[model samples]
Target chain A: MTRNAPPPADSGAVRSAGSSGSGSSGAGRPGFLWAVPAAVFFGLFAIVPLIMVAVLSFASWDGLSDPEFTGLDNWRTLLDDPVMIKSLWLSVLLTVLGVAVQTPLSILLGVWAAGHQRNRAVLSAIYFVPLLLSIAAVSVLWRAVLDPNLGVPAHATWLFGDGNLFGTQATAIGVLVFVSTWQFTPLHTLIYQGAARAVPPVLYQAAQIDGAGRVRQFFHITLPQLRNSIITSVILMVVGGLTTFDTVLILTQGGPGSDTTISAYYMYQKAFKSFDYGAASAIALLLVLVSTVISLIVVRLSGYDKMRSTMEGL
Target chain B: MRKSRPNHLAGFGSLVWLLVVGLPLYVMLVATFQSRPDYAANGPLAFPEHFTLDNYVNDLNSGFAQYFLNTVIVTVCVVGIVVLLVPPLAYTIVRSRGRATTTVFRLFLLGLAIPSQAVIVPMFFVISEAGLYDNLIGVILPTAAFAMPVCALILTGVMRDITPDLYEAMTVDGASPRRVFFQLVLPLSRSGVSTIVVFSALQAWNGFLFPLVLTQSVETKVITLGLYDFQTERGVDTPGLLAAVVLSMLPILIVYLFARRALVQGLMGVGGK
Candidate 1:
């Protein structure tokens, strides 16, 4: 590999020049060539495909023929399609519900786990187990456990009713949200746990000295201190929720109808099941736009982009 | 630490959450060890009448062994590609003052926001046109590419923590960039290397969307996809289905048991993903 290439011929001369002026432009620095391989590789698989997605959004293809440019036909049809509109709403609903549910729950768990007690350590370790399972595995496990006949629903009919949870719209959506929260809250909790542990103790001491109790200290000190982590965790949840597919595929199959078919799963159906590559490309582009806009807005509002430089300073 | 009180409220809450997290896990485990008839008769939450390993045995006797092999190959290849490519890239992003290098860093930052689902449509076309569709190579390439931005971000963060004085000392010793990289940068960033290896390995091992879209044959089926097929194909066989689910996560569970700290750190780094 080029990583082991010999130093430039002037290296001895540059060394003799000494380290007094070893600034950003020093001769010891690697060239742009070092970044080429990753850049090209990422470009081929991520960037190029992204561009092709944009172009394909304007063309029609069915995986069996060449794509032909169709202008805004796909977009027009999507604009009028009720399922597309509903899918967008469902995506937003799931994302918002995910953030709403996971944020506070993980925050509480994270702060509680930040304690150094022996029992807390053991409990936190158990909480971390769900993070080990893949999303597909988690979904499959939940599906079987929630089966109306042989699973928990049969025994616990008081809480679950007839247990046709997947047969209705509300329960199906509830299951999607709950399953996601179950699988992902641990990751977010870990994030908040790290952040909570990093909160300086002197601040809490000052709060206590000022007659603030535990709850007050949490709101005044802990919540304010965890601002950046809150942003990061929420962004991850939103993106994960928007693009959630495997769980939906395994759990509900977007079912009872198109009730649980969020935009990401809908896009898969459009392209693969219906073979409407053009329409799916449009939905894909919409998803990219929605996530980017939301991410940028969050970054702008919270100054997260500026936080990157502060992290660089570390 | 503020040991102001026993915090009985928080303890109770934790126990409640423990049940929420633990109950399904208990069900999955117990069901996997029970015969199907026992499971059907007693329900998911009931104690098993007799323990059995038939579920796991049946799953392995089926196609799971092949899926495990395929997932292993994908994971190793993805991790290998990431290890080979990302260090050099992160090293450059840290050390190189070139304008292009900054652009490359920004590119990855932008890449961070582009989810893989957004490009699956064109990715299928591109992979097929390249004659790689329905091949493990098809899944490997895209998965590795998507994993790079996060790995680059993490490794660069780690490398950036190596102070300027260290780099200057190496420069003062007349070391070339390559020498400095191998001796100082690589050794100093050992934790970061392991973090990326664990991170990318998990991503490759558990990846679903790419394999779901790009590949079709049973030959290239990864564990996640195989589990999905099991659910759709033999969903009613709860024990067998849950056993496959357990099988899909076994390797990661072993890693977690042995290297809990490292795995936790690696997963925390996935916050950037």
Candidate 2:
């Protein structure tokens, strides 16, 4: 696992950013001649389509005719659209709530699971089930589960109430949030567990000897030690929340009255359903802008570049 | 040796949390096994007294199997192609420090940021032009490409991790860069490769938007798209839809169970702090 292996001679000095005494005796041409096909494929498929998206974002189209140049009208409409506005707000709300709810729960589960190594494998396997399923499938499953009349929630209502629970907006959002957290908790738990595993056992021993109670030791030792993983998970949750489309589409299709609509879902409806490609592109551009700004801020605030280098170092 | 109050509290909390977490899944499983009348009569949270496999049987008979195969084919092919393509690009980017490398990386990132939903119209034209309009490869190609940016970014991160020492060492020993890449970089980057495979496969298997717009025939239909079609066709065969969902999710569930470690490792790479 160590990157500190013995360095070869010829091109060895070229890599002397770290390893010592491995002189460049066999120096020849710089190596990198076999990267052609992959480069071409990535360029044609990934790189080109992105350029197309940016260019088309400004073009006015009715889906059949050649795209017409309509300047910032699309952009202007994006700013003025109420549906877009509401959905964006909803996406932000969901992200905030999702992070707030999932983080502590994941930490608790991870800490508990990590401590009892005996059942760790079995527990981790069971926990990761939701991550593997398609978002659409999860939605479908939950929809049936939350069916007020014939669904699972109706059955569970004997405990809470024998009323229509799924029809209410707050309850619906709560269910969505709960479902989202269920899928995402396993991811965060894995992250926290990974970090916790990396914490040296001697530190915990030291804490125990210092009369640190379990809760006290967790806050003082585990939480502080897992700062990077916590930041990573939160950022991921935020990005995922912002870009969410599939589950919402399958579960509610923007809901009984657009209550569950998110920005991405709204845009999809605009472009495809309404044939408002221009408006859709404009909305998508704005989404990209928001996500980019948020991502950059996250990268900076989380010290992501430095952490990436450090993680690589490890 | 100390008080047991905290332990009791922790145990109680764990049980409550487990129930909170497990309830939805519990409901789904039970509902899937219940008779339609029984499902309608009883609330979802209750367990089914009679375990009926009829829902599953109906789903399997109702083209769910075909959808499952299509999804598997598309996901496997997309993952295969991406795995074949991304590593060498990453190696070149890491090994060759120049404008070209920087430009390529930036290009991939641009693709990453530009949501594909924006350009579905042009993409459809392009797909048609290539005579792949209704083909799974049409979906597969774009899906694989869309995934490239993130994959390349991740692979670049991983490739960067493969201490330059190994490649340099290989070169000093008179091995060609190709040999070094195949022998050293690929072998060293096994985890990253697995990460890419798992991520790409999930994306392809789970993708809906592209397939929904691009393909028209049932033959080219993936599970997500197929489920949509089934829902549209049947309106609301609730038990059958749930069954299709359970079937569709089987592969991912198995993969996640076995490779949770790698998936976590991969998540760290993509969701890197």
Candidate 3:
């Protein structure tokens, strides 16, 4: 993974002096012009809209009208909006729950799949099927599979008990978290599988020689060795969970009320549904802030930022 | 050096997980092949009394074919844009010493943090403002943009592995940047290019929120949006709905079967996206 690769040694200073002409020592190096097209395109769609989100958060606009600067009104409304508060809470709760549920499960499954056994290979292949499905497809499939009257719940009454799973807040949120877990665990398992395979067999061998049990070896050696992958997987889960929109839309529509309306969905509702673009922008900004802070913390902790120069080493 | 103890606990757990994973899939497949009346009568877990292809036939006739085409167009265009732009940009990031190139790389790093959902409000405005609203171009542009950061990161990683000695040899032979790019860089980064192709294609194919918000007409609707509308419009038609769900994944499943390694590597790279 790029995250663990050493920062590329800075050879730019030595090469830049001769980079002025095509036939210079740096003649083989592509110039900054090569990056301009992608940068401009990304800036237009991503960066420019990000700036517009910030500006619009402070302004009032419907999809039809011109945005008018309203000072702090949108921000003030969001601060007071109970649903906004609840949505933030729900986002956090779901994200944390996703990480908690998926981490250990994926870690175990990943390490298990890392084994070279043929059955492990077959089982892992089956395990990976869910990852191939889109969120919409998965949510739609689960919705049918778990339908209260016509689906699994109808037949498995002993387990589902009326099967109005999406009718209540707790069950609705549970469905969201579970569907996300079911859909995403395989990807994380793949990550951990790769990481686990890369763990030195010597470490596990030494631990075995010391009479460490399988569980003990997993705890002391495997767990520690998987630290970086854990961080990478957790970060992906956090971001994916935070911006979880499709599953919510397909499965519950954040519903039975605003019960499952996490921030992302709520923002969607505010802008597109209610046409409150200003308020939606505010929520969008908040989502960005939260994700950015979380990403920065993880990147800093994992020294991912240091890997930014990975290209320089080439 | 290995313990010979059969791990009953893990075996049990794995079987349980297999059931959890496999059961729904079985239900989906069975439902897709059964008529609605047959499905409702048999329940999701039941074996089909009479297998039929009507559900799939009905879904395809009901505009799923168009949705699939739209999705393919979006996927191909997104992949094309990513392929055309990203390699050169990644090449620049890997080989250039210019300060501006470094800035460009960092910009993509920041791009990683900007989820499409976050800027969607303004994205709606921007697309509409550009007169691309409700057009496939509207969906295509932003989807490609969002796919770029991850594609750039992956390709750059692949390019960086080209060993400086290889570039030095090419340079000593009086190869220009273009010559080396074609002869050495492009060929060596084949895996990375394929990975990005798979990555960006998946993004465009599976994209929902962008199409959900941007395009409304059936003509522009992608498969994901088509499925969403299918679920919302006819939620009770389990067989038809599941068939559409199955259809939505069929292309990727085909890709997965033929290029499992590349597809898996591509999905793992999506951790960044």
Candidate 4:
């Protein structure tokens, strides 16, 4: 916790004082005026709703009538509700699968792409195609492409992997995770690619001169150099994993034993389908609390705050 | 740097590049052309034997044109508002660096960790209560709201990367903070502006959960919602529905192609990964 205080005090404080001293009186300046709309917008929309979720979670309302105070009811139900708990479990399962699959694959591709400059532009375009496509379009596109009776999967289920990908519970969530990882792997690759390219070539040359093989160079030079990027991208992966809903909504609709149902999807179903705004709000607040804690832990363990603050000052 | 030979990667990678991304895009384009009967006869993967404008024509009949317009309106408004608003905010945060600035910056950073899923619960009530529910204005407000945090954060990183000497020179010249803002800050931060513009536009364009939950009527529905409903309505007509999908993707994809490098740099710059 004290880590947040370290680098900012050293550099940030100095910068603030230096700028304030060098410039004229800072209050009532033009820049602060420019920030007013932004601050207000976030207040009304971002932070206010955040507080609203907290309050609404403790009230009973159908989103139309007056919300009456209902302390601990939603929370107690959440604790015992198998559907919500299962969805939460599924979200964690997804986070694990996503991290496990995306991290190394992206690193490898990123390394390969970093060195393979001959087709860099073309390859980047190809890879970034998925990133550019709309999520809704991606959802429908994959649905058609992966259909058992209709598309590529119909012809090559053995090689293409699943024929009835969205149909069977056993393979449904796995397939959903795979398609998602494929679509998003490019983004992770880009991050890793940027990180890898930032490393100087001299490190590799010196290691090579020391009789370090390519694999050895990768482990010692490349991996260590990319430690921050890895950690950062893992945070992206975990947050993304936890908040996943569109793919499930469009592709599976939480079908085949509700295997692909994530916490977000559960919230969506409760609020939209069952029309239980109070319970849904409870889920919302819980997810935010849990995810905030989880992300902070990830950042702490990854040394992200320590590394990034120093990096920023540099 | 010494160049490495292609080895066998040339043939293998070329195939993969074509197969992995190109195939789905190809299927989509091909499926869009084949008539309904032709689609059924040849299946989803087969090339269209008789290509026609029927799917496209049918899609326009389904009010897809209005959906396209709605998407453009919302996306452009969100992007414009974000670009116009965030720079000044980012400038103040970087230039001042006071207690208020730092606290504000931290608040924005906290928004990055909190996805819109958490806000949608209360947001639904807020929008409906304000009588903005099922309205495009309703969608635009919240979309821009969610975008503000990340946009401001990225723009701050960019503005901080501005050399302090630039500010010093402007200050020494007796430049008003307003002049220093427009005459200096704006010109220097063109790349950053474009970065947030492309970023927010993408966010708005691809926004699903918001448009899905907030907008109820067809008149207010953006293209993403439009596309989803189109698929359900025309699920049997694979090519027709896909044609609509392709149409919805075209505008954003066109922007992406021209701004690909900048988009890549923007995403990387934001450290969003």
- Score candidate 1 by DockQ: 0.62
Candidate 4 error regions (>4 Å): A1-31, A157-162, A294-314, B1-18
TM-score of chain B of each: 0.97, 0.91, 0.97, 0.95
Tell me which residue pairs clash in candidate 2. Answer: A10-A26, A151-B44, A152-B44, A152-B45, A155-B43, A304-B273
TM-score of chain A of each: 0.88, 0.83, 0.90, 0.85
**TM-score: which is higher, 3 or 4?**
3
How many clashing pairs per prediction, in order?
A: 0, 6, 0, 0
All candidates' lDDT scores?
0.86, 0.71, 0.86, 0.79
- Model 3 residue A69 lDDT? 94
The candidate with the higher TM-score, 1 or 2, is: 1
CA error at residue B144 for candidate 1, angstroms: 0.7
Worst 10 residues of 3 chain B by lDDT: B264-273
Docking class of 2: acceptable
Q: Considering every candidate listed, which one attains the maximal lDDT?
A: 1
**Cα displacement (Å) at residue A133, model 2:** 0.7
Task: Sort by DockQ, best first.
Answer: 1, 3, 4, 2
The fraction of correct interface contacts reproduced by each prediction comes to 0.75, 0.43, 0.75, 0.56
| CA lDDT, candidate 2, residue B222 | 82
Indicate the residue-level lDDT of A10 in model 2: 36
What are the per-residue Cα lDDT tens digits for candidate 4 across A150-212? 777777867756577767776788777877887888889888888888899999888877878
